[model samples]
Target: MARVPAGADLELDVQLEGVAEGVLVTASVVAPLAGDCARCLEPFTSVMQVRFQELFAPESAEPADADEQDAVESYPLDGSGQLDLEPALRDALVLELPLSPLCEDDCKGLCPECGVRLADAEPGHEHEQRGAMWAALKNYRAAGPEGSSAGEEAVPDGKAGPERTTDRTDTAPGQAGT
Candidate 1:
């Protein structure tokens, strides 16, 4: 989630050259960024710098070749001969921004159970592993009444107990035993 802070001033060094087909803009940018660490969720501040070159061509120009069409994105120039640099800056900075912004290269993050920072916790800090069935039963029992212990056998709504067995075989309407 790292991004440039609002109202932050950027350092832009650009050179606009008039080429045969269009204006070739070579620029170097430095932006101030602030965000939370993706691993440990801690606030951090950083600075990013990037250098890029792009061509601003007239709106009526066509792609020279198929390879050039895919490789170069020609930013269209307006008919009045004025161009805005916002779109170019936006594209360059957005592509250069890191997807996973880390406070440190080797951040250990946090403990899964106690929610403690892993780096601050003891080396052997861990929780007892419970079985899947045991964990589910424990959660289910906890959601019920406080007095309802696992040792007790509770019946269903219409009175089903040891007498109501599910092993009954289907019999004909008139016959009893085969």
Candidate 2:
């Protein structure tokens, strides 16, 4: 047995049986690994354990039919009883990593105005002014038609432009009310 990373551990027990020309090996592994939080980008750790059954065929064995031998690996057992587990452990750690990690469910993230982490902000602190485009549109409307009231002008027939009229209500310089 090989030591897994401190974050995760691995435990494997194997039993081999001879079934005709092939050998069957059943094993299990338990381990831990570390991951980064997706939202706050903080480090987090988790544990995992998995069991698998695999069959090993002799180097001399050959399938008589065209059908493929599925889920079987052919290995020539070395003189030493030990089988290197690096590949299996690598796969286990990779599989255990989460698709997405988060330090908290609702991470406030950094404020757009000051780049301050919203998670640490003082309560009831108003966020800075952000909507400038809307203010500009309101100002445009308030300054309508060269700053004159609609009823006092004739609206220039089909021209669709502000009408200049000699009517006293419109011609009076101070009568314009926005």
Candidate 3:
């Protein structure tokens, strides 16, 4: 509860049954929770009901068997034979709390590029295309087949103008004549 900044309002409906070695406690908690939406950062509130049963073993009681101890989870009673409910209540509520709360099921959230809320923005709202890493190629195409700039030479029929080779005579077997 301390970790959750907006602490929940807890209402517990509890029942206790005494056994030979321990007390069985059944609790249903109605908690009102408030937090900000994970996506759109909008504030939201909700009510969560969690029901759980746990065994509070007496301080003098030992496990009946290793398997029984391993299978069942039990909280230890205090030296005065009083059961502490805070830890149990904390566990039940915290487990049910939403990790990422949302104002609505499908929140569009904010635009990464402009930081504008997508929910409030006009439908089909978009910014002009900002060029990407290959933006120069786009501009090159926009400048026509002549070239991106007037100083540059025109490409020859969509092919490299001429074969510029070094003194090396190496060629793949099939590519020798081609």
Candidate 4:
């Protein structure tokens, strides 16, 4: 959830060196990041510093070896050997962004029941939670007889049940009527 905003200005300190194949660019970037916290979901801003090195080479001369290929990039520099540094800067900065960003290391996040920001809540904040087995009992009052067969007594949960029938002629086989 963390990312750098588009159109944000980046501060760059760069060193250009002439290598055998191309111009090597070594740069350190300071970027402004804006993102939502993964836990508390609060908007926050932070600064990230990244260091990257890349070779801006002509597109015609492709690196032959896999290892060498990674060390050098085939970026088409302009006729004057001018470098386009945005892609290299983006790649380096994105790798350093935290996947699960938090407002703080000790952020408590939102309460499960009330959804209030737990960090802002009073000390020892909690709700009256029942155990799973007992928690299911609360639905009995509203659990109407959705699948109860005819002639069997409906569960007594302070709600109305079907009218009782005296005849057992229509009852399914082996099912006793009450």
Which candidate gets the maximum lDDT versus the true structure? 1
* Clash count of each predicted structure: 0, 6, 0, 0
List, residue by residue over 1-178, the lDDT tens digit for candidate 2: 1223554445667677777756666666666645565655556565556665555554445454335544345444343555445554465446655577454567666666766656677874455355465677778877875655663344443244434344444658666653
lDDT (Cα, tens digit) per residue for candidate 4, span 43-75: 889888889888777665764677877765555
What TM-score does model 1 achieve against the real structure?
0.59
lDDT of 3 by residue, 1-178 (tens): 1124355457889999997658889999887777887887767776778898888886556456778777777888767857798788778778888887776779888788787878889997676565453586777677755554443444432343344222223355347878
lDDT of model 4, residue 147:
38
Output the TM-score of candidate 2: 0.44
What's the candidate order when arranged by decreasing lDDT?
1, 4, 3, 2
lDDT scores for all predictions?
Answer: 0.78, 0.55, 0.71, 0.76
Model 3 stretches astray by more than 4 angstroms: 1-8, 79-81, 122-178
Model 2 gets an lDDT of 0.55
Candidates in order: C-alpha RMSD to true structure = 12.7, 9.2, 11.5, 10.6
